[model samples]
Target: MESTAIGLWGIPLAILAGAIRVSTPFIFVSLGETITERSGRINLGLEGTLVFGAMTAYAIAVVTGSPWLGVAGAMAAGASFGLIHGFICRWPKVNDIAIGIAMMQFGLGLAFFLGKPYIQPAAPHLPSIPFGFWSGLPQIQAALDINVLFLIGAALTFALRWVLANTRIGLTLRVVGDSTDAARAMGIDPHRVRLVATAVGGAFAAVGGAYLSLYYPGAWNEGISSGQGLMAVALVIFARWNPVGCFLAALLFGGAGALGPALQSVGVTSGYYLFYAAPYALTLVIMIATSSPNRPVPGMPGALSLTK
Candidate 1:
């Protein structure tokens, strides 16, 4: 039942399973933040957006009995929040960071108020593809039970990477991110582009939320996120804002996240709690390594306020 089936081998297997399961949310959120940052704006408020999206997805699934609809609702809610953040930040003298923080608080408060009724309801869970069906072992089957959204997010990472490198829209986004003056010179509306990018980013973040409530944790609660949305910021920096890199970084973080449970499954009770903090420790290490003033991070968008 535990990691006893395959002896010590089950530890890595459990971690692998956990990595695939836990990394889905990170994949989506990091990719979303990558897009937003690539457009020269930052949205720290995605933490709020992620929680609200989870609540919206859970409530919608309970009411509509359709997990997909729940995902859609979450996306709409997240996008709307992104649009609001973009619009408000566009006003003179308004800081993006300040607006993002304000939006985060507002979203959390709103979600808590609206989500109370949904705490007791059970919703339809999202389906997963049994990639391990060929195996007779239950452990193997369970380990290979990959979710549909994980596939979608994985595919989207490569797709997004290609789009950013090859498309006109990508060019415009890159230009806007690199230099506002250059975007204006090319007759592009930087503000409008950023607004749209932020919205798109929010939609991606909400899908991550959908994955959380509708799949993994499979419930609605105030504490569902556990800062995955916020941690995505550091992830983006670690990956240098590349979509493909984001996907891989997410898997690493996910593996780290899975360490504790994997250890517990193997009957190693001692200090397993510390293993849960592996992802946070990884984040801090990445930040320290990348934040040297002498050597600026390459590939960082020049126009991003993070540069300032």
Candidate 2:
């Protein structure tokens, strides 16, 4: 009876653990999206970039027997993709959203074409910290074995929040996002600012892909990413464009994601497929709750297209 009671209590703990593990990618992707959207651009192609990054990271790690190299390669690929988006969007009357979709398809196609051989190959895994070493419980130890990316994602969130609120570069980013004309008037090149921001955002998104391939699932496969990349765009909107909010919202999404597995573990299996929609449902709810006909949220960039 006592063990049964303990098991019931463990359900929530397991969910929390799953949330922590699963939320890392969401944290990175959402934060990256926040940065890009804040700079008055949106990159829907991050989905493709993510898939390509995952494949590249896995292929590199397999060849070199070094997971760190995989991360570096992923960042390079992401940055290159971002550069392409930035350069192309600079053209007169270019539709950034359309370009984003095209980029996404291009990325996915490229990843599938290049990653064909790596599908079955084994690769090195990313390092993890053993925070549960002192807990003396198997569940605790498993929970504590956190990937380093989680910490990095958390730190980046706080750092980004501070930079946007306190830094001169952040001020300029805001100006460009709000109004390109205003940016030109202030002698701050909106195009240049947006280009840099998009590239950085791509790099971050690539890291999220790296985490998926080399750490969480840790493999090279065509299905490595479902819709995490696309869902992140909605997450940025749901977070109201705040990096810190993005973090917390990611955790919530993660928890929603873990619901199905958690429920199945203890014999609750009524609506398995429905559980998969938890994150999307939350996203829709939040969007409805916060959206307005006029005036964006407090932290949202003025030039962002999502709000309009």
Candidate 3:
């Protein structure tokens, strides 16, 4: 059966599908930010990183004819961006947040300049799992075609939560986040830890970009990201820095983001573009509801400047 067989009732299914598709990038980027923030650093440049990653992945996939290789290239590019940010941030007087904004612009400019040629080239797409085998309806089966990276993102969520709770590396990150002096006393180099964490964060964010280009909406262009990287920063805050919470929050945001497209898909065309505001509105509400001068969110890292 074909996916077009569904009637008006397919709206929900379409939303579900869109949520899964849209949420994958959010899941990965938020997870990366969670890790970076937990280590007492923030990388707002991820918006740029995400865009550049999409370009790198698409270009590589086109040249190599392998989507997986494209993903690898994107990760590498992302890590390099992180490295630059980390190194620049090591100066005593440097402001990490400001640097992040600068990096974001730099990355966007570089990506646009380099990606112009690749925009017209075709690239291979990542594979997916046919999760609709049990469903008799074409819409159901089609909606359930799960991408491989989504599974990995889900796993990373739980795994990150567990690692932060139980592992030695997790302890080091927490100590660094709480206080650099404490980390130094424990013989952990805070700078090295943060650099490594930021790099890993960048790599993860890049994978999110790869998923964007090599999977859903599968192509390379300047606007492929739609501010997903920036939104993921808010997502990390909404999750209270919890990896598992990040995953669930990503789904919520994803669902909200999908509302417009879902409605349009079902022939409900009223205020179509307004639906994209769902995510931004939700983020603002979450931030406002959770924030107060007397009591801040519980899980914020001590060294984070944005919340502090």
Candidate 4:
């Protein structure tokens, strides 16, 4: 009876651990997407941006022997990708969403091409904080090895939430996203605002990718990313564009992602491949539940193309 109770408890504990392990990328990417979406531009190319960022980060870390440098490199690559997307979108008659998809393909190609050499090289990994030191259990200690990115992501979420609600710059971004014409009328260049926002968004997304390659999975490969970047976009919607909500939604996604493997560990033998669909299925269900036929939610940016 005690063993049975412990086994049941392990499920929730494993879920929590999975959340910690998996939520970092989701938080960063969703937050980045939030910024871009808030500025009336969407970078669907984040998938590519993420892959390229991972490759850049891993390669740089391998060369420099510093994980931090890899993060910086990832940010630089991401910003450059964002700038390209922004520049293209600024051109008259260019479809930003379509451009984003194109960028993703381009990024993937570049990553595969460049990262080919670094596939076998090992890079320095980011440091982790062990919060479970006192638990005296190997599983607990492993579970509590929280990555720095998770803390940074959490802090950024609070900071962004505060900025969007109170700061002058946030107000400008909101105006630019809600109505480009209004922003232009106020002498604020919507293009400039969007460009900056997208750049910042890309930087965050890239960091998420870096975390994936240099920490969690901690390897360089063409298949390092598994739709995390794209799913993050959907997560942004499920989060209702709130940074804090993004954090919570990310944890949910992480749990969904962990379910299949965790179940397999416990001798459960049903629908392994289909179990992988949990996160997407949940996202779809949430979207259906939240969407309305009449009007947009209050916090949603007015100019967001997705909402329309």
Candidate 5:
């Protein structure tokens, strides 16, 4: 029913297409993580938030026949998770990282259990723009058929970068993240700002999950997310918690992920599985390159637990 292309030239094109497709989830998750971390809180549980959001988005889409509505539901669910994490961490002597790990497992279990029945059902997919229509080459047309969310993610990246650099809320977040004491001294509630930031972070991650289930791969299942959430944590580190950097880092991961399929498309199967490891390898490389025992990566938020 589908025709595969046959040409050495297609390899690069294939990689380009795959990069856009695969990087979308990364873009969203890292952007979300950027927000949370910038507020001086880390949310490793985003993997769970991402998974549960996938389940929620898929389930609602199937029931309501409107993927947009499903996305809204996913955002609400993700925000609830973020709120739970933020609130618990505010308690005296609480461990945020451990809570995030526990939440990740809980989200996975809950999603797997509730998503069982709905896996077999089909849902409406999000729409994409045909940017490649002008190209006579089918591969180019396919490569340019980008989802609207990717565009939105790009816009958010720029908007976030600007907001963080210029806005009053941005100033508050920076103060809260750099020194909780300073925030309190200025009559700003660090806890309140962090809580809101985490909620926003969760909402963004949920949209990424929505893209996963309702767009790419275009289905609901137990295996919809394969650690994209976790990878995003490393991505945030790699990006130095900068929104623009997160967007570029996401695209890099996406390109790495697409490398495998691009090679396969060119009939290189000798190390197909190895190609799948590209993103992880790239992640390790980035972390190693940006870090050392000598000093914290430049731009790391001072109040971050990792930095401490």
Candidate 6:
């Protein structure tokens, strides 16, 4: 390992920077999962949607030479996947988890097959705001270079929280989440609500995927998502279905994810690769700490199958 000007100090700074850079995808995916779970439904198939979205985004960007259009295409593709999942799960005695798994397989297969062609093409990258311009240090500048999607995700966190707490739509969603019977009594359509919520959640997850390809990793490949879609489901639970909590949890996970690379940057490579498992370990620890056989997770929707 070679010493640089930054030396040992780079580890923490790199982790901090990586947190901001990496957390964007987590924020979007967890928020999306939170929204879906809040509506009394779970979409484990988001992994599929995420990969497919990345593929669609990259393909669109390559063809149209417009990153924004690629984003739209990804959203549409993700929503379509959600629509299929929702429609199938709506049938009597059908299992949502099983259907989700199948959908995930289908999506992965589809993305891999189609994404192969676009793997060699370079897509236009999404724009970023140089938040570090005020600082003279190149490290500071790189760390603070915030993406536009990150800003949107941050604003969306507050907006989603407010919408879930203070709006009529939020009330109806809560009613549906609490009980389908209650929703029916109140003239609300729980199935429709869940369908729309799942679609919206998928769209959000797709945006996260778009961010993965069009921004951070900025590439299209079968493994681009790196299980983020699946992890977001657990993240939603960790956040207790709260959007703000999702944001915080995402940053924590992002920091954990960045730990290895940060350590490596500081010449701490002896066991640096182990840090790559930090996020998964954190997830396991959180699950063990928070979960109990005697009681349900706090803030979990009453109608959620896991609660039963």
List the candidates' TM-scores in order. Answer: 0.98, 0.95, 0.96, 0.96, 0.97, 0.97
Taken over the whole model, the C-alpha lDDT of each candidate is 0.91, 0.87, 0.91, 0.89, 0.90, 0.89
* Runs in model 2 lying further than 4 Å from the true structure: 1-5
Residue ranges of candidate 4 with Cα displaced over 4 Å: 1-5
- Tens digits of lDDT, candidate 6, 119-180: 99999999999988998777878888889998999999999999999999988988898889
Indicate the TM-score of model 1. 0.98
Candidates 1 and 4 compared by TM-score, better number: 1
Q: Provide the lowest-lDDT 10-residue window in model 4.
A: 1-10
Model 5 ranges with Cα > 4 A deviation: 1-6
Tens digit of lDDT per residue, candidate 5, span 1-308?
01255367687777778888998989999999999999999999999999999999999999999999999999999999999999999998888899999989998999899999999999999899999999887888898999988999999999999999999988999999999999999999999999998988888888899999999988998889989999999999999999999998999899999998888766678888888888898899998898878877789888998844
lDDT of 2 by residue, 36-152 (tens): 888899999899989988988999999999999999999999989998999899999988999999999999999999999999888989999998899866766776788898999
Please report how far candidate 6 places residue 63 from its true position, in Å. 0.5
Please give, for residues 242-271, the per-residue lDDT of candidate 3 as tens digits. Answer: 999999999998889989988877677889
lDDT at 8 for candidate 2?
A: 74
Arrange candidates by lDDT, descending. Answer: 1, 3, 5, 4, 6, 2
TM-score-sorted candidate list, best first? 1, 6, 5, 3, 4, 2
Q: Backbone clash tally for model 5?
A: 0
Residue 200 shift from truth in candidate 1, angstroms: 0.7
Residues 209-249 of candidate 1: C-alpha lDDT, one tens digit per residue: 98999999898888888889889888999999899999999
